[model samples]
Target: MNASTTQAYEPESHADQNSKNIIESIIHGLDTFRKFSRLYAFMGHVAGSFFSSLLAVDNLSQLNPTFFNGYLQYIVPHFFMHLYVVGLNQLADLEIDKINKPYLPLASGEFSLTNGIIIVASFLFLSFGAAWMIGSIPSFWGLLASFVLMTAYSVNLPFLRWKKSTILTVMSHVIGMTMSFNIAAFMHMKTFVLKNATSYPRSLFLVTVVMPIFYAVVATAKDLPDIEGDKAAGIKTLAVRLGSKKVFWFCVSLLQIAYGAAILIGASSPILWSKLFTVSAHALMALILWNRANSTDLSSNISLQSFYMFIFKVRVAIK
Candidate 1:
């Protein structure tokens, strides 16, 4: 009887082990999803512009489940698009990333190249298909432009790898970001949601124009942390040409100037609250940037990587 009991317990224990393995696999997959998709980055990239347009149009009063569902509809494809953009870069820069970002799924051997290709291709199709189905002209064109530019930026081909040129790289980033983040988002809200005469609000116009300058800083600053890999890979990023320390300070000064401009614009606002709020927020932000920059150790790889992430946070905060 004791032998029979042990035999029965063994089967149950084996079954429990199988169940645990399945659950652990799922958790691991989710973790990989987070790393690959960079979901928070997507939020920072699109959420501000998307909702800012809605806010400008006074659409908050229409809040409901349906509104949120529509929001999901709009963002899901955009998120997939973001995944494709970043993933393609990783795919193309596997060697460079092995040096600069070894922990990335592709470079680290956690996710296979075949799997990465399949997923990225699927995301590209999904984004384009969803855009066509939604029938948003601005979004479709903007997505197309981004697809082209990012492909050119990453893929090594005859006369195609735009990342080798600082001007082309910066232009790609600025144009792609402005089109996808500002113009497409705002126009989608205008043409699809509002469904009336087209007009740009003061806030939206300012964001649209100023966003390019900010994105230029973002583009240049991103390369600062990748100087080693980029230099080895023959990429001519500003960080490579000028040295990381010099490029770092240059990016900081550009952002500071942008903040100063924002403060000036806020002061010119007719409303007292707008003036007070904008001026105060930008001033605080500028101070925070300088403090962070002063503390950063330019020589340390870890410090440079951390500062790169801090730059993303600043982008989201400003948005």
Candidate 2:
């Protein structure tokens, strides 16, 4: 069964409900750990970004055997990047999360701070080790960059704070994604940038541009549901800083703008018919967001769930 479904069965009372609560809480804590880390988003984004760049390369050149072969080698670095981001994001957010996301594992008392330290240690070991195994110092540096930025945004780095500023909040996403895209491009330079411009198909550029824009929007969309807690905690996210009305308009406007840009870019390019699927997915999401954003307050769980679902849908579409 699903984690949430399993989580729902925890008893409210029992002879030893406190002990049982602790166990159930641990389960829920793990679930929260999985959910908020944006692990799925990170994986999907890396996969989409990498493959779209590859497809761009394929479309630009005659299909060569070497280009087609050994593509799986990329997955090692991709996994390393995703693992680092997911684990680090969760660990970094632990403090702000207590205020803005009280339902999270640590905030909800599902896991102790001591347990959290152990988890973070394990996550770092696996992440850095994977990066090192990929045989690129740059890849390991990228892993380090992920940890540093996550920490800067969520915990320390008062000098470069994004947790309490709307502009910085959105800018952090753009910067992070830009770094990911550039690092991925650097790692797979042969496929991402070797084609001559005169011979390069426009389809590749379309994918590169559209994918990152989609990622930025998905990241910002997450802020909508956190406004209440953010305000209470003095975390001036886009939602809290702009207030609900402006944030609503901002998200919708971004969705429409990105959708329009994607459609136009795709139509003008030579991307395959299958690639049009991402556009269709975004159109459906726009409709879903419009309907849900109108009917639900930002603080409602349904609103938060819808935001999460949209991120998942975007990931699937791009992949």
Candidate 3:
């Protein structure tokens, strides 16, 4: 071939290589987004928030705000809580993620701490802004506490870990449950007060707070799958402290007792039967979740992931 012909071939070759590189880069970027598990994190906050909200406020229609404030309340707190949960998981599972979830954006070098920090800041700003819109100091501060817990969990503080302090895990779950419940309750209250300010029932206040604690116990079962990861990471989850079987049975008993309690509550109380039925449904769902929680067969590990996914699906379907 002549020199001119050779030159032409070289440019074509370079062009082909560049095209391939660009295509690969695009594919990898999309894959990294999936690994970040953003949707799953959002679903966690949504689930916790939805159930708690259901318990607190009976009517969903009363949340209308005059400005963007209404939409902000509905969206911002959950956004912050969800992102915070994702960041904390990535931070805590730093080692375990290296093994099991290396494809995660941070673990795989597809994303950076700077990127994570930016995302978290955006969430916090949106959350705080939403809380401000709600016009309730206590509830707004509840969201602020949610942000604080998220920060505590994401950063390695002096005394907080799976090994060093069960208080972290305990308080984290309790606070999360309250955040969700309170949002729901606050919305419901506005609805009730708007419709019949004079006749607003008082019992709802008690039920909203109590119900999330019970459901929170059921959500604790997810800690079981993380047992090995938790142990390796030197983290102390409820499963680690309670024993896998113990955690399973304890959740099961909690579900059963909650169900029975609802039946009894309905039989003797003047409160809404729907409230009892709602708790009953959650307890039944927990019982169903317990079946997978008790799986000792070891061969069904993949199935267990599916089971949890199903739980998530059902929770989302409820609201």
Candidate 4:
């Protein structure tokens, strides 16, 4: 071919190659999103925000058009915050996850360490920026608490890895989740009534107290599945300190306590139908959890993971 002809073909080839690269990048991004379980995080924030809003208003009527707008405002920032936290945890635990959770994007080589870092940093920026735009006290506190807790849980800088300590791990999850709940509640109040935001209700306080026990169960049960990785990493998780069997029973006991408390609280309700339904529900849940606990295979990590998800189901029921 002549020089002019060759040059013309070269430009076309370059354009095709660039287009292919762009398509590949988009596909890889989607795969990374799937591996990171972003959908579950999104749904979780939705449910948490909804429940918190319910607690704040204490009536179904308050869930009007404005409630949804406020919800979107709250969830947008919280969603990015959740992403930031999860990404940071994955980045910090890449090696450990390679052993325990090889399917993760970072551990599986679907996303490079640099890619993960960029994703995390971007999410962190977006989380804070969205929170600032919301401009509510609850939004500010939620963002701040999430930053502090996630930093303590994941960031290894200055060795603040709270995951290495069982108590610290549980406390971090409890406090972080509580802050998340209250953030939602505050967002609802700010949206509806800026001047006189509702004070923290007694019911929410009780929820904060009881829910942490379940959070502790989830925290420890999660470790039961990753015992090998945790042990190798010199992480003193509760499941590492106590045998998996013991940890399993410990979680079961916590569930029982939580359900028992729910039953007692339900029994004292003034409304007869509410009392019967709540008490019956808790009783049934406790029995079902006990039965499942009995049949669960403590030796299998998958089974333990399933049980952990079951705890989440029970938590939703309680809510």
Candidate 5:
């Protein structure tokens, strides 16, 4: 009787264990989805599309259904490119991420390194393939430039890990952001069959100059919260080299200069309404950034991170 009772209990316990294992696997799958691709960052690409759309249309009246369709077509490839770049970075920085961003899928063990590799590979194939399918030389070149920069930043080769050096890091970001903007802008221009390779517009030139400076600040500030992890990993980021306080002030000054320049441009715009709106918006953004920077508690990583996102918001406003 005792042996029979034990045998009956063992089967039930095994079944229960199998169910628990399945549930755990499901939970981890969900976490991987949440943390791996980082869907929130997709908004940057969407904003790029919006700016491109604005530049593509001659006026509000020209923004019809076709314009919207073109935006979708252009944005899809951009989105995959972002995923590929970001995913590769995440994969390459798995150790650093374990220190600086433990909640990330690969770092947290919610997703295996193999899983990350597969996802990034898929994104890369889709991004380049989609760009080719679009059959726009400008768009393809823009994506190619972005891909090269992103690869340089992530690949662990001599002088390739641009994230380790301050100057290289800044240069990489500047070039990357410029390429990202151009990718969408050029795609929009292509959709309308506009004259490609013509003289650059004043607005385009301004954006090209401004975005790099803005991205420089963001790139430096991003390292602030990860200084400890970066130092531990022997990655000499700007924050690690200059100290967080100096880097913070440096980012602030850069932002101030950017906003000042925007305000000046807005003031000089020939259109009266454009002048007022741009000037007012930039002024407000400057004040907000200054206030946030002052109130930011450097010791609180969350606070610093939030302020960084706020900077991104200000950037979008300028656009």
Candidate 6:
């Protein structure tokens, strides 16, 4: 080919290569976002937030495109905030995660410390910016509180690192995630989509009462399998302070109590179908939790991890 013809081909080839690079970069970015998040944890938050919001939605006719878009307006921000929460822990607990959760992007060596930091900061920006754009006081405060609490829970700063205390850790999750996922989502939907006066629904009351117990269990039970890492890191999680067996049973019993409370709460519902379904569903869940706890072999790390994941899964399946 002539020089001019070769030059023409060079531009096209360069263009194709540039397009490929752009596509690959985008694919990598998306994959990193996924890897940065824990699937069960993400689903649990998403399900809880969406369910709480729906509880506040009174009118059947309101479940329209506009209402869902409004839901997304808040949910997307919460999603980013969750990423920040989880990622910050991974960043602070890199060595601990390497011991307990080696497959995580940062722990696995697939990502650098810088990569983790950037991913975390990017999510923080997204979450904060989105909440600001939405201009909802409840959403803003909820996100801010979640960010602060989770940051304290994970970050290894002086006078911080709330994960070092069992009470602080449990309280952080009980208040932090519940406020971010349930209360914020509920208020946003009630005031934004429904455009109604703020009043507590029975559903809201049930979740508020039950979720604190559930999160307490989650905070403590999560340490059961990570006892070694937590111990090494000097994180005084319940499993580290209390023996695995004790902490394990403690979490199970706590969850059972929450379930029992839920059942009683359900029975008081004035809606007939809601009362029956809620009561029966919670009863079944309580049984299942007990059954699974009995079968799990706490001495085995693999078994404990599996059981731990099941507990997290249950939170997602809720409602």
Tens digits of per-residue lDDT for model 2, 174-276? 6666455544433443432343332344555655565556656666667776666566666666666666667666666666676667666655545567456
Best by lDDT: 6
- Stretches of candidate 6 off by over 4 Å are 1-33
Superposed Cα deviation of residue 304, candidate 3 (Å): 3.9
How would you encode candidate 5's per-residue C-alpha lDDT over 179-217 as one tens digit per residue?
A: 767544654564544433444455665676666778888
| TM, every model | 0.94, 0.69, 0.68, 0.87, 0.87, 0.89
For candidate 4, write residues 179-239 as lDDT tens digits.
7855555554555433344677655765776777776777678788999999889988888
Off by over 4 Å in 3: 1-31, 47-72, 133-139, 162-164, 183-210, 241-243, 269-301, 310-319
lDDT of 2: 0.58
Write down the lDDT of every candidate, Cα atoms only: 0.81, 0.58, 0.57, 0.80, 0.78, 0.86
> Model 5: runs farther than 4 Å from truth?
1-31, 190-199
Give the winner by lDDT: 3 or 5.
Answer: 5
Candidate 6 residue-wise lDDT, 1-319, digit = tens? 6998999899999999999999999998778667778757878888888898888878889889977898888888888998888889999999999999887889988889998899889999999999898887788888998998999988888988998888888888899878987998888888876788999977788889888888888888888889888888787777877789998998899988989898899899889998999989988888898999999998998899899889877676556
In candidate 2 the C-alpha lDDT for residue 231 amounts to 66
TM-score: model 6 vs. ground truth = 0.89
Per-prediction backbone clash count: 0, 0, 5, 0, 0, 0
